[model samples]
Structure formats: C-alpha cells, structure tokens
Target: MEDCLRIAVAQIPVTTDARANGREIRAAMRAAAGAGARLIQFPEGAASGYPSGAAKAMLAGWAVDWAALREELEEIAALAAELSLWTVVGSSHALTAPNRPHNSLYVISDTGRLVARYDKRLLSFSELADWYAPGAEPLVFEVDGFRFGCALCIEIQFPEIFVEYARLGIDCLLLSSFSRDPMFAIQVQGHAACNAYWIGFAVPAQCGDAASSGLAGPDGRWIAQAPQAATRLLS
Candidate 1:
C-alpha cells in the first residue's frame, strides 16, 4: 500500500456538558465521513472539557466520576456508528477496579466498537505522584492501511517513544496535548523532524485560555491549526 493517508482533524471547543460536547463531535465526525476521511481526530478530553485535576480545590475529588464518563463514552460509541467513521479522541478515563484515574485516548471504529485505549505517559508533576497513574506499554493501532501509534498530551516530548514506534514501522503518530503555550510548534516540528516520514495528530483541549488542536504533516508543516480562541475544523 502507498504511504499516504487522509485524516480529518477537528478542533472543537469542549465543556463540562457531555451532551453538548457529544453533539458537536457527532456533527464533526459526520462531516469527516462525508469528506471521505478514513480517520478523524478530536481535541483532548473531547467528551468533557472538565479542567485538569485542580490542586487543593473542592473539585479535586470530583474528577473521577467513572460511572458518568462510561455512559458518556457509550453514547459516543453509538455516534461513531451513525457516522460510519473511525475516531481518535483525547479524554479523561475514570479510574475503577482499584486503580487511579488516567488521561486517555479512545479509539472508536466505524461499527461503534471501542477498539483500544492509550493512557498518557510522561505525567506532569501533578500527575506523577498524584491524580493519575503513569501509562504502561506502547500502543500501535491499525486503521485502514495505516499503522499508527498513540501518545497523549505531554508524552510526545519524549523522543525515545516515537523512535520506538518508528522502529516498529508505524505509518502515523497520534499525539494529543492540552497545552496553551507557544512551545506547541516545537512539539509538532520535533515530532516530524525526528521521525522524518511521520505525521502527528494533535488535538488540544481547545480555544480558550489554552491552545486549540491541529494536524501536522510529515514535512513538519501545519496542515490545519485551530484558532487560539475559537472552535474549528482543521482538514
């Protein structure tokens, strides 16, 4: 197969309202399908834009509502089927079964099946010792003819991980980040410069006080960049 791929990059704003967030994502996925896109990427925590674990706040304990997130993701599954599209989304995973919570990326197939999960590695100081459990293992998921690896948010900073995936002959790299800083350019360029033939998928938390999501080409160029303060679709 050729080493070319068509990806739909979505940069929609997210909120704590699951229903609203779901509705927007469903629409975007449908648009992506209509455009003949095989894969669609969305912002980090696309399901619920709930802020990252805030420190020493009354809401600190409120972030791990596993039951609620499960139901929300189930609906997202159904929506994926409706659109007949594959989706990669960055979101928070509620902790259950005696483990701490995680910032995760969920991969959904066209048939509404949840194919795999990749938890974010390189946890921040906040997450390293508290709030989340560090992710284990590397994920290489296949969609269409594409073999892609998944890494969430800050994990892309670590060059060794992507090198490992490239050594395995991955065709694409899906990176999800929640950064608002200008270093984002460095992140995307670095992801491409090191991997050379690799394309990076970045779906940030969205336009607000923070940065939005976007896509970068193998040449280390921006394919599409969501606005800093507005939600948009980046093809």
Candidate 2:
C-alpha cells in the first residue's frame, strides 16, 4: 500500500439538470487527473441538484428523472475508469414506489466499478419528513492504504459519527455537503483534530462563497482550499 495519496476536493456548480451537472463533474475529474490526484471528492448532490427552500416543493413531488440520473452516474464512472481516478459523487438513490429515495454518495473505484454507496443517515428535519428516506448504515472504504469514511450534510452536527469512524480505524473522512454555512468548515476541522484523521470537505461552488471547500489535515489545519465563490479543485 502506498503511504501517500493525492486527493482532490471539488467545488463545482450543481444544477437541476443532470446532464449539465455530469459535464461539470467530468471536467473536474479530468483536471484532477491532470493534477495527478488519485481520488476526487464531490459535493453532495453533485449529479442531481440538492433541493432547498422553494426547490423542496419539487422534491416533495418527486420530480427527478431516475433514468437520466443513473445514466449520468454511469458516464461519470466510465470517466473515472478512463482517468484511473477514484470518484465519490453525491446523488439520490431511487427506491421502490411509495418509498422516498435516499440522499447518497456513490463510490466508484479506479477500475470503473461501483464499489460502495453511503446513504445519508442523519438527515435534517425536512429531509427526513419529506425529501429523503434515512439510511441505516455507515460506510467506510479504502484507497492506497488510506481508509475513508463517508458523511453527508447535517451529519456534521453529530460527533458520534466521527467517533465511530475513528473507532473503525479510518485515516480520513470525506464529508460532502450542500451547505452555505461557514460553520461547516469549522465543524469539520474540529472533527479532523479530534479524530486525528484528515478530512476532505467538499461543497458546491455556491456554498464556497460563504466558506471555501477545503482539505483539513489531522492537525485541524487546511492543507488546500478552493477560492471563495468559484468553481475550483483543491488537491
């Protein structure tokens, strides 16, 4: 296992259009690959836009086209394979009728395989009541000797989750969010320091305007960060 691995944290624009979102994600993957990053972490709902405020009305009505979303995901996986880069993308996971979908992160390996999926377990009030079905399990995956745990927006409020991942022996935590709160960055840094593990915090470009997407080292210091209010990659 390699002792060092280069990972990219992406701050990209996410729209309601799956195709448009896929395009931006693919471009970021190419850039990260060019920068020699082995893995890239994207913001929550990078493929399918995250619903908020007025958008929640559309989500309550179940407006997403599941097929198009799946196609976009597959294309992203193919691109990850081509670049030999591990990719983590946030999207909605469809379930049977009468059941709400899950807010989740899809983990694609460098070999172009869907290795794992981490569904958001601790959802916000609106998410649990209307937008999504809460997930039951936590997820952890490995890359180049580094073990990584996955968490989504709002999960930052729960320190037990971070402690659990630490107990599971993960070296890093990948926390993806659709938040515009600067406190998100502060909370993630605290988690990194408490757990003695690196934290890759990815947020949408819109959110970056409030607090930049960044990578926090074990010492609770930023290793890299994207510029505020910009779509960029932090490697």
Q: Which candidate leads in TM-score?
A: 2
Clash pairs detected, candidate 1 = 45-90, 153-176
Provide TM-scores for the models.
Answer: 0.87, 0.98
Error of 1 at 85 (Å): 0.6
lDDT of 2 by residue, 58-110 (tens): 76576777788889998999999999999999998989989999999999999
Clashing pairs in 2: none
User: Could you give candidate 1's per-residue lDDT for residues 25-131 as a string of tens digits?
Assistant: 88788888888877888767787554554413534554434566677778878878887778988777766656776778899998999999888877878766656
Clashes of each: 2, 0
The 0-to-1 C-alpha lDDT of every candidate, in the order given, reads: 0.72, 0.92
- Which regions of candidate 1 deviate over 4 angstroms? 53-58, 204-212
Runs with alpha carbons beyond 4 Å of true place in candidate 2: none
